[model samples]
Structures are given as structure tokens and as C-alpha cells.
Target chain A: MRNLFAFISGALFGAGLFISGMTDTAKVQGWLDVFGDWDPTLAFVMGGGILPMAVAWLLTKGRRPALGGEFPTPPAPKIGRNLVVGSVLFGMGWGLAGLCPGPSLASLSYGGFGHWLFVVAMLAGMMAAVPLRARLAEPAEA
Target chain B: MIEQDWIWGFVGGLLIGLGGAVYLLVNGRVMGASGIVGGLVDGSGMRTVWERVAFIAGVILAPIPIYPIYRTVETHITSNVAVIIAAGLLVGIGTRLANGCTSGHGVCGISRLSLRGITATVFYIGAGGITMVLFRHVLGVI
Candidate 1:
């Protein structure tokens, strides 16, 4: 039952990406173009996503845990250098490639060859981080 | 007043957001795509593995139903495969460094009114914005 729900939810997400035209690289690139044929599509997409999410949050507040038994959701982070640095890196990559991880994966199912490289490189990047994160934590242990 | 594209975008975002909410309400877990995927590799339980595999499969197969409805022409901004690969790698690393992707931190985290999610999202958006300025405005990629 849990697996079924997750699968359905994921399907919905992929459908959203495709319908929003987010899977299309041109639309993504258009957003990147500030002066040249600026496309507000991505902004619109994000805005659309946020509205319902806001309402859902309100509805679900104070509710007990539902799936996979009980677990406390992680605490939200305070604003800091991590936020700034991470955002900058994410935006730079998005602007350059017009693909984020979610849509990148979605695009792959649609025969999006562009996402092939993005997906590969993304996996590599994740793998690379295991050691870096370990190294960063080493000093804390010391 | 609504353009066809905007209608599609709005609907798509809503579905994705709603689906996310359903997952949270039912599972007590944030529907972070990367985390779900990651769980497949590292998670110990049989349930966890099944859920992750199902979710990923759903995401991959979602475009099939929608392909006939919106037949937008696909376009590629950068044909260079290397660039795409590099961008994906960067995102993977960034997600790991931050401890979540946009779906986990940006969508689920923010919805729960988490400070960390809000901070992570800010960075995620900021990164896209700055990268756009640099790539399109400064470097003239777009």
C-alpha cells in the first residue's frame, strides 16, 4: 500500500513536469534569457506549485505522522551562508543547463537526450559528495 | 485570459503539489524524489526498497499519458553533451551537500513551514537567478 501511494505520487509529479512544459529545454532556456525573449514560464510554474502547497501545509498542520510509521520531520534551517552558497550554485547550473534534478529525470522518460548527460553527471556529483561530506565532518570529530 | 500554456502550467503544478500532499498525509514522509531514489540504494527495509522503486518507475513512465495531449516541439539549447553532464553532476553534489533536493527541501520542507526548507529553497531560487544573470547576461549563453 505504501509503495502504491509513492508510485502514484511520483507519476503525478512527472505528469506535472510534462504538462507544465518544464520537460521542454526551450522553455527552460527561455527563462534563463533575461533580455532576449524573456520567458516567465518557469516562474509561473513555481508560483502555481507554491499556492496549493501553502494550502496543504495549513490543512496538515499538527497532524500526526502518516506513512512509514512515526518520524519527526527535520527542523528548518536558519538563513545563513549555506543557503546563499547552495542557491547560487543551483541557479548557476540551472541557468547553464536549463535542467534541475526533478525535471531532468522526467525529461529522460520523454526521450530527452539532453538530460542524459545531466543525469549521468548528477549521479557522479552525488557520489563525489560522499567523500567530501565525510572529509568536512572529519574536522568536527577531531 | 488564461493562455493554453499557462493553463497547462497551472494544472501541472497543482497536480504535482497535490500529489506531494497526499504522499505526506499518507506516509508521514516528505516526497523528495532524490531521497526516494536514494533509499532504493541505501535503505534497509524491504518496504523502503519497494516504495522507492515504484516511485521512480512512476516518475519515469508518467509522460506516456500526456504526450498526446500537449505536443509541444522539443528544442535543445546546448547540443554539447559534456555541458549537460557537468550541470547534472553539479546538481547532484549540491543536493547532497544541502542534504535534500528541491522536492524534499523546497516543496515538502517549505510546506511544513520548516526554516531549513525555506532557506534551502531561497538558495535554490537564488542560484537559478544568479546563474541566469551570469550565463545569459554576462556570458551570453542564451
Candidate 2:
């Protein structure tokens, strides 16, 4: 039952990304291009996404353990190194190529070498982080 | 009145939010695309692999239905393969390190108004915007 629900939800999310034209890399790139022929399509998508999510957050607020399982821990409040540096790096990549993971998966059907290349390289990059994160977790040298 | 692109963006955004909200309401998960895929790849999410697989499957399956209705969603993705690959690598590492992306931080994180989410969003957007300015206007590499 839980898995089915998750599948359906994922489908909805995917559908939304496609219908919103988010699956189109050009559109994402256009939005990021801000100075030249800037497109506000992503802004609406952001607004459209935030409204209901805000409400959902409200409903789930008091439900510490959540309805189905123990709630995942909220991210720490402090502005940390990983968060800032990672975001900057992601921004550079997003600026370079508008393909983020969600759209990348959604647009796999489009099947261009570029998308495939990005996906594979992205996976490799994710893998590279495993040891990096492990190293970060180790105690600092004296 | 907004253009068709904006209208579709808003509607699509709503669906994305609905998808995310449903996942949270039922599964008590964040439904973040990067985190979902990244965790599994890194092997941390192995315990809950089925749910992640199911969710991703839905995302992949989404375009199948959407294609019938929204034929010809044009794309202007970069043809530069190296740029695409590098972007992919950066996004992969960045999201893992930063812990979120557009879907996770831009939508899910900002909606809840979590400090980390907001800060991360600012940095990524700022960096992306600046990168675009330099890349397009100054560097002209893009």
C-alpha cells in the first residue's frame, strides 16, 4: 500500500514537471539566463509548487512521528559549509545546463546523447561524493 | 493574463506540489528527487530502496502519458556535450554535498521556510544568476 502510494505520487510529480514544460532544458536555461530573453516560467512553477506544500507542511507540523512513519529529522538551522558550497556548485551546473535530476529523469524519454551523458556523469559524481563525505565525517587531524 | 507558457507552468507547478504533498502526507518523506536518487546510489537508502525505486519509476513513466497530450514540447538544450557532462557532474556532487536542489530546496525546503532550505535556495539562485550574467554577458561561453 505504501509503495503504491509512493509510486502514484512520483508519477504525479513527474507529470507536473513535464506539463509545466520543465522537462524542456531550454526553458530551464532560459529562466537562468535572466539577462537575455529571460523567462519567468520557473517562477510560476515555484509559486505553484510552494502554495500547497506550505499547507502540507502546516498539516504535518504537529505530527512529529508523522502518520505513516517516524518523520525524517529536520535539517539543521545553521548555515553550514556543505549547504553553501554545494548550492554554489549546483548553481554553476544549473546555469551551465538546466538539467537537474527531476527533469533529467522526466525527460529521459527525449533520449538525446546530451541527457544521457549528463545522467551518467551525474551518477558518477554522486558516487565520487561517498568517500568525500566519509572523509569529511572523520575527526579533524590534531 | 499570463501567456500559455506561464499558465501551463502554474498548473504544472500545482501538480508538482500536489505530488510532493501526497508523498509527505502518506509516506512521511520529503519526496526530494536528488536526495531520493542520490541516497540510493550512494547505498545509504538501501534499506528503503523499494520506495525510491517505485517513486523514480513513476517519474520515468510520467512522460509516457504526458507525451500524448503535450506533443512537441520544444527543447533548446545545449549541444555542447562536454558542457552538459560537466554540468551533470557538478549537479551530482553539488546536490549530494548541499543536500538539496530546485525540487528539494527551491520547492520543498522553501515552502516549509526552513532556515537551511532558505539559505541554500538563496545561495544557489544567487550563484546561478551571477553565473548566468558572467557566462552570457562577460564570458560568452554559453
Candidate 3:
């Protein structure tokens, strides 16, 4: 049952990304081209997303949600190297491809070879990180 | 068609938020693509991998039924296969390292005013903006 609802939510979210300009690399690229022929479309998307989520947060404040579990809160660790470096790397990639995971996965249907290439590599990169993180975590390293 | 993109962007963003809210309300999970997918790959959230996989299935399949309606959903991603793969790899690894992406940190995290989420969002976006400037303006390769 939980899995079913998760799928439904993902479908809805995927539909949103598909309908929004997020699925189109051109739109995402254009939005990023702030010094060029910039497009403000994404700003609207961000605003639109924040409004409802804010409301939901407010409503669910001081209580566990309708699901009878705690909200998926952020981890409690302080800011560190991984967060900054990883995000910067992510930004560079976003600039390069103009597709994040949501749009990247959602748009796979129509993304053709180029998009598939990105997805496959993305998976490989993700899998690769597991061992890399372990290696870094090894006390012998530093 | 292009002029009204923000309108669709807004609507789609709303649906994304609504989907996220529904997921949280019913399943006690955040609809963060990177975290969901990354967790499965990195083997941290092993207990809920099935739920994450189900959501991924939804994201992958949701656009199919509506493909006819949004036939214009093609990607203009660059043809440099190496760059494409590299970008994907970076995004995959980076988002995992950072623990979120646009959906998780930008939408869900930021909406809830979580410090970590906001910090991650700012860093990634700032990095993206700088990357865009370098690639598009300074290098003229994009």
C-alpha cells in the first residue's frame, strides 16, 4: 500500500516535470542562460512548487503527518565538505546537460539516445560513489 | 508556445508539489528523486528500496500514457556524447554526495525551511550559475 501510493506520487510528479518545461533541455538551458536570452519560466515553477508545499508544512506542523510517520527531515549533521563539493559538481553537470534527476528520469521516454546515455552514465556514477565513499571513510586514508 | 511556458511551468510545479505532499501524507516519504534513487544505489535505505523502486517505475512510466498529449517533449541535449555522459555521471555522484537535488532540497526541503536543504540548494544553484557563466560566456562551448 505504501509502495502503491509512492508510485502514484512519483507518476504525478513525473507528469508535472513532463508537462513543465523541465523535460525540455532547451527550456532548462535557456533558464540557465542568465546572461544570454534568459527565460524566467523556472522561477514560476519554483514559486508554484513552494506555495503548496509551504502550506502542507504549516498544516502538518507539530504533528506526524496523515501517514502516521515522521516527516522526511534533513539529517542532523553540520555542513561539511561532501555537501559543498557535491553540489558544486552537480551544478556544473546541470549547466552541462540542463537535466536533473526528476526531469532526466521522467523525460527518458522521449529523450532518445542522448538522454539514455545520460541516464546510464548517471547510474554508473551513482553506483561508483558507494565504494568511493567507503574508501574515503576508511580511517587509514587520512 | 514559448511565451506561455511559465504558465505551464507553474501548473506543473504545483502538481509536483501536490504529488510530494500526497506522498508524504500517505507514505511518510519525501518525493526526492536523487535521494530515492541514490539511496537505492548506495544501499543506505535498504529497508525501503522497493518503495523507491516503485516510485522510480512511476516516474519512468508516467509520461508514456500522456506522450501523445505532450509530443513536444523532446530534449535538445547536446550531442557531445562524452560531455553528456560526464554530466550525468557528475549529477549522479554529486547529488548523492550532497544528499538531495532540486526536488528534495529545492522544493521539499526549502519549503519546509530546513537549514540543510536551503544550504544545499544555494550551493548547487550558485555553482550551476557559475558553471553556466563559464561554459556559455567565457568558453562559448555551450
Most accurate candidate by TM-score: 2
What tens digits encode model 2's per-residue C-alpha lDDT throughout B110-134?
Answer: 9988898899888887887888888
Residue-wise lDDT of candidate 3 within A1-142, one digit each (tens)?
A: 8888888999989998888779888888788788888888888887778788888777676778665778766577467667777788888888889989999999888789989899888888888777655554425424
- TM-score, ranked from best to worst: 2, 3, 1
**Which parts of model 3 are misplaced by more than 4 Å?**
A134-142
Q: Please state the CAPRI-style docking class of candidate 3.
A: medium
Q: Chain B vs. true chain B: TM-score for each candidate? A: 0.85, 0.94, 0.93
Instruction: Give a tens-digit lDDT track for model 1, residues B25-124.
Output: 7766677766665544333334668777777777778887777666753646487776677677777766766666767777677666788777777777
CA lDDT of each candidate?
A: 0.70, 0.85, 0.83
RMSD, every candidate, angstroms: 2.9, 2.2, 2.8
The DockQ-derived docking category for candidate 1 is medium
Relative to the unseen true structure, what is the C-alpha lDDT of residue B80 in candidate 3, on a scale of 0 to 100?
A: 88
Cα deviation in Å at residue A39, candidate 1?
1.8
Q: Please list all clashing residue pairs in model 2, or write none if there are none.
A: none
Q: What total of clashing residue pairs does each candidate reach? A: 13, 0, 0
Between candidates 2 and 3, the one scoring higher on TM-score is: 2
Per-residue alpha-carbon lDDT of candidate 2 for residues A25-83, written as tens digits (9 for 90 to 100): 77887888878899999999999999988988887867842346765678758776778
- For candidate 3, write residues B43-93 as lDDT tens digits: 887999888988999998998998887647777899988789889999998
